[model samples]
Target: MDMWSYFYTCLVSVWLHRLYVYSAVAFGISLWIVIQFTTTRTKRKGKKSHRNPSSPEGTSDKVGNGCAPRQAQEVHVAGVKIFYGSQTGTAKRFAKALAEAVTSLNLPVEVINMGDYDPEDGLAEETSSRNICVFLVATYTEGQPPESAAWFCKWLEEAANDFRVGKSFLQGLRYAVFGLGNSAYVDHYNTAEELFETSSEEEAGGTDSVVDVEDLGNIMGNMKKAKREQELQEGAAGAERREMITPALREALTKQGYKLIGSHSGVKLCRWTKSMLRGRGGCYKHTFYGIESHRCMEATPSLACANKCVFCWRHHTNPVGTEWRWKMDQPELILQEALEKHQNMIRQFKGVSGVKAARLEEALAVKHCALSLVGEPIMYPHINSFVRLLHQHGISTFLVTNAQFPEEIRRLEPVTQLYVSVDASTKESLRRIDRPLFKDFWQRFLDSLKALAEKQQRTVYRLTLVKAWNVDELKAYADLISLGKPDFIEVKGVTYCGESSASSLTMANVPWHGEVVSFVRELARLLPDYGIACEHEHSNCLLLAHSKFQVDGEWRTWIDYGRFQELVREHQRSGGSRTFTAADYTARTPPWALFGARERGFDPLDVRFQRKNKARDISGC
Candidate 1:
C-alpha cells in the first residue's frame, strides 16, 4: 500500500479499538511519520525559532513517550480535543461521538481520556496554538465526581487556583464542559450548571421581586434586564434543581441501581418566554447547542415518545405515565406559538449583532426542525395531519420511533426522514434492553423495519450500540440490516445514562466511538452492498448503506422534501382515516408523481452551525 493509504488504515484500525491508550499510541506514531515526511526547511526571524514542522514554541520541549510531532501538534486547530471523565464510560462514549462530529469538519482531532493524563503535568498550560476543549464529565454516587474524574477534578481545581494565585497558568486555556449527571442526584446534579452562570447572586436577588409596574414603564429595558437575570437564575437553578424524587420512585430506582441512571429526564432544553430574553444571548460553553449544532434548534415542540428503550436518557414516567394524554396541542396552534416565540427571541438578540450581524436574522428565526420531540409523536393518532401541517410551513421533521408502532408508521404520511432506533438484534436482547409495552415488541420492530423499507420517503435505521448488553450481536445486527435493506443505517454508541443507570448500565459499559465505528464498518464489509457514506468521527456515528433515491437522475440518499410534502398532503385528502390498514404501512410511495429533491444551495454545515438564530425555546411536558 502507498504511504497515505497505509497510514489511514493503521489510524482507522487503532481508532476502531476504542481503547484510548492504544489509540493514543497509534496517533503518536502516525504524527511522527507525517512530521518527518512533511517537514520543510525554514528560517528563524528574531528570537522566535523558525523550525520546519516546528512545534508550537514551548509545546515542543514539553515531551513524553506519547508525544506527537510538530505537525501532529496542529491537530487541535482542525479537530476538537474531547476529554471525558467517566466512571463506567457513558461520558467517554458520548465524548467520542462528539469528537467524531467535530472531526467530520475534516479537521483532525485527538480524543484523550482524562484518566490517561497526570493533571498537573499532562494538561498543557501554555501553547501558541488554539485547541477547543470538550469535556464530558459524569458525576457518580452521592453527587460526587465519578471515580475516573478524581484526578481531573483535583488537577482542574489545582490548575485554576495555580493560575489565579500565581497569575500565569491559564494562558491559552479555553474550554467547554458537558456534565453527565442526573437531576435526581440530590446535590451535585446538573453540576455543569455553574459553567454557564456568570452573573452575581446580588443580580439574582434584585430580579426576584422586580415589580410589574417597573416592566410597563420601560418595557424593553426592564424585559431585557429581567431576561438576563432569569437566564442567570435558570443557570443556577439548572445547576441546583435536583430531579424531584418520591419514595416509590426512589425505591424502584434503588433496586435497579446502575440501570436507574438511564432514567434521568434527558437534559431539558432551556425554555424561552418574554421573561428570559438577554442581550444577544451569548453561547455558553456548556449549553447543549455549544456542543453540537444538532442541539441548536430552538424547540422540541412535542415530547411524547412511544417505546421505552432500556438505555434511554429519559425518565420512566416520561414513557410509561398515564398523565400525558391529558396535555396536548393541535399541530397548527403549536407551529404558530412556537415560531412566534422563536421570532421574539431573535429580536431580543438583535442588540448584539456585532461581528455576526450578517447571519444573525437567519439564525434567530426558528425554522421548524421537529424531531418527534420526546414521546411517540407518531402515536398522536393525528400524526399524519401533524406532519402535513409541518410540511405546509416548510418545516423539516425528524420522527424517531421505536419500531413497536409499525401500524402508526403505516398510517402516517412519509415524514422528512423517518428514524427507527434498533437496539437489539434478537428477541431476547430486545426484551432485556427495551422492556417493551407489548410482549411482541421484538416482532413488531422487525415488522416495522420491513415496512420502513418500502416507504418512498427517506429512511434511516439507527442502531444504538450498547457495550455489555448487545455488543456481541454484530453479525446478527448485520443480518437484521440486510433483511430491512434501509437506505441509510446509522450506528451510534448508547450513552451510559438515564434509567439504565439504575441497572447494570454504567460508564464502564459505554464503548468509545472507534469501537462503534469498527463494528459498523465490519458490518458494512460483510454487507458489501452497503458503502460507508458519511461519518462523524468525533461523534462516533457512521452512516452506511446504498443510495436508492435519484436526485436529478443521479443516485443519492437524502430526504426528498418536495415529494414528502406532496405525500403528506395527499394522505391528508385522499387517504382518509377509514382507508388506513396494516397494508397501508408498507404501501409503496411512488416518487415518480412527486417532485425531486431540490438542491438546497447552502451548505448544511453552515446551516447546522448558524441555526441557533433564536425564538422561544420550549420543552414539552
Candidate 2:
C-alpha cells in the first residue's frame, strides 16, 4: 500500500513540475511581447510628435499630459529693396519687372512705393554691404517731386528737421536711380535724379550756388595766360591779353576740340559746315529757312550759361554763371575777330576734295551768324549791339537762347531768326532737364515765352524730342506753344553722341526719322493752324509752320535775305521805330521743299533720284 501511495505522489509531483515549466515559459513569452509592444508604441508616439506641424521644430517635451517650453528661433532676410515714385505707373511696372528678374538669383526683393516708404523705418540704418535700395522715380510738374514722393523730397530738402538722423545719414546708404523725364523741359526733365544727387551734395554742403563774378574774371585771366603760353610754344605768339578763366575749363574746352574766342567766347565748326565743305549740302535750316549753310558762322559771344542742359552736346565743359562776370570784349572787336577766325577756319577746307571753290568763297563772306555754338549767346551784355553789328555788316543773325532771362529777351533787338528752346511742357521737367541756376527759373521761363509772343521778328520754338521722355506730353506741349505763339516749330530728334557726363542719354533715346514724322503728324492733328512744312531725313528734324505762312498753298517760310537786309537798314535809319515783321521779308518756298512733296528737297538732278525714277517708270511700263 505504501509503495502505491508513493508512486501516486511522484506522478502528481511530475505533473506539477511540468505545469510550472509551461506556465513559466508562457509568462516569459507574454512578458517579452508586452515589452516589445510598449517599445514600438513609444517610438511611434515620438515620431508622431516630431512630425506635428503645430510643434514647429518638433521638440515637444510632455510632462504628465502638458507640453513643456521651447527656445526661440532667429529669422534672416536676404535681398534688395526697391522704391518707386510713379506718375503714370511706368516706374511701378519697372520695379515689378526688376523684382521678378532678381527672383532667379535666389534673392528676396521687396518693392515699395515712395508714398508708402519711410527712410526712418530701418532703411536708413541699412549698410550698402548687405542691403541696396533702388529708386525709380519720375519728375512731376514744374521741377517738383510727384505728389506721392513729396514727403520724401521735402524730407531730403530739409535734412536739419530730422534730429535722429545726422547729415551723413545717407552716407551708408547705397542707391541707384533711374529717372523718367523729358529733355524738352530743360529745368525739370530729370529732377528726381538731380534731387537725389543734389540732396547728397546739400548734406555735404556742396549744393551749387552763385559764384562771385571776380572769381570768373580770375578764371578767364588764367585761361588767357595759358593760351598765350601755348601760342608762344607753337611759334604763333601774339599780343598777351589780360584775362582770367578756369584752367580746368580751358583744358576741357581744348580737349573737346573747341577754338577759344577771346576770353569768354568759343567757336565750333558744325557737322553741317563740314558737310557743306564736302558739297553734300547744308543743314535742314538751309532748305527750310533760306540759311546759306556755307556762309553761316557758328559762334557764341559768351561761352558761359545759367543752366546745365542734359542734352547739351558740349558735355557741360563750358563755364556756368548767372551773369557775365568776366571782362567784356566789345561787340565791334568781337565781330572783326569772329569774321577773321571764321575765314581762317574756312581756309582749312579750301584744298579738301568735294569743296566747291565758289562755295568756299561764299563761306568766307560770312553772310550769316548762328549764335548757337555753345552757351547762352544772349547772356552776353553786348548781344543787342552784337546783333546790330551783324546787321550792319549785311550778315543775318540767328540767336538761340535757353529762355531763362525774360528781361533780357524783352529788351533784345530783333534778329533775322530768334529761337527760344521750349524744352519742357511742364515746369517740373524744365527744372530737371535744364538745371537752371535761377531758383525762379520756371517763372522766368514763362515770362520769356510771353516775351517771345510779343516779338515782331521771325520767332521759332525749337523742340528737341527724346524718346520715352518728352514724347508723350503732346497736350502740354501744345499748351506751351499757345503761350509762345511762335511762327514756326522745329521738332528735332535728340542727337545721342556717345555718352555724356551732363546727361544720361543713350542711343535708345534717339528717335528715327519715321518716329519724328509720326510725332509731328500727331501734333499737327491737334494744331490745325500749323502744318507739317518740311523735314530733313538726315538730321531727323521736322518743321511745323502756322497756316498763315501758307499763303494760297505756297509756303512762305523762306526769309527774303535781300528784303530783310533792306528792312534792317530801314529800321536802323528810322531809329528802330519801324520794326520789321516776318511777313514783311517773307519769300516763296520751292515746291520740293514742302514736307509731302515728291522731291522732298532732294535735288531733282541728283543721279540717285534719276535712277529711282527711271526704275519706277520701267516697272510701270
Cα RMSDs, all models: 31.5, 22.3
Cα-lDDT of candidate 2? 0.76
Per-residue lDDT of 1-621 in model 1, one digit per residue for the tens?
599999999889877876987778899999998876665422223324443222333332322232445344322242356777776577878988877766665655777887786656644541223555566777654344666667767655554445343433333444555667643233445453233111111212323321111112134335457866876787677644323234465464445421121122111223221112222222211011111222223334334354455566644535342113333456666556655654554565556524244344454543335453355555555566656766777665667777877776776676656788888898888876875655456678888888887776557778888888888887888888877777667777876664343344678777886798678768877777776544443344556746343334433443344454555566667754423222222222222211121211111222212236554322100
Worst 10 residues of 1 by lDDT: 282-291
Relative to the true structure, candidate 2 has a C-alpha RMSD (angstroms) of 22.3
The local lDDT score (0 to 100) that residue 168 gets in candidate 2 is 61
After superposing candidate 1 on the true structure, give the runs of residues whose Cα lies further than 4 Å from its correct spot.
1-302, 317-328, 342-355, 496-504, 547-555, 559-621
- The 0-to-1 C-alpha lDDT of every candidate, in the order given, reads 0.52, 0.76
After superposing candidate 2 on the true structure, give the runs of residues whose Cα lies further than 4 Å from its correct spot: 1-244, 603-621
Reference-based TM-score of each model: 0.45, 0.63
Give per-residue lDDT, candidate 2, residue 21.
Answer: 80
Give the range where candidate 2 is weakest over 10 consecutive residues by summed lDDT: 66-75
Model 1 lDDT, residue 372, Cα = 36
